[model samples]
Target: MSDEEKRVLLNNAWCRDADASFAFGYALRADKFGIVIEGKCAKCGCAIVRCSY
Candidate 1:
């Protein structure tokens, strides 16, 4: 996929809620590898987890 497509996919990735207090964001790359996430929990103050595909 092109860089633009990859960027679009990354911007619309899904984030799982396992043990997080805040909603995390994800970004998918064109390599079809894994997803990257950012942000921390507001209540637990723990690092947000990202479930990659």
Candidate 2:
């Protein structure tokens, strides 16, 4: 993904266990509703998926 898009996605990211990490890149994929960005949390390492329309 583009740097700007990555920045925007991470800006709105959240994790159930803790604050999400600012990683290098996310696993991007397509979904029925929108684009899905997957990553891990900084504190707890839980899976985090953010969907962008």
Let me know the TM-score candidate 2 reaches against the reference structure. Answer: 0.69
Candidate 1's displacement at residue 41, Å, is 0.9
Q: What is the C-alpha RMSD of each candidate to the true structure, in Å?
A: 6.4, 2.1
Give the local distance difference test score of model 2: 0.75
Instruction: Please provide, for model 1 over 1-53, each residue's C-alpha lDDT reduced to its tens digit, 9 standing for 90 to 100.
Output: 47785455444433343443443343323335565444555445555544345
What does the lDDT read for residue 20 in candidate 1?
Answer: 34
What is candidate 2's lDDT per residue for 1-53, written digit by digit as tens? 68898778777888766765645456878789888888777667778788899
Model 1 C-alpha lDDT versus the unseen true structure = 0.46
Q: State which candidate has the highest TM-score.
A: 2
**Relative to the true structure, how large is the alpha-carbon lDDT of every model?**
0.46, 0.75
Quick one: RMSD of model 2?
2.1
**Residue 44: error of model 1 in Å?**
1.8
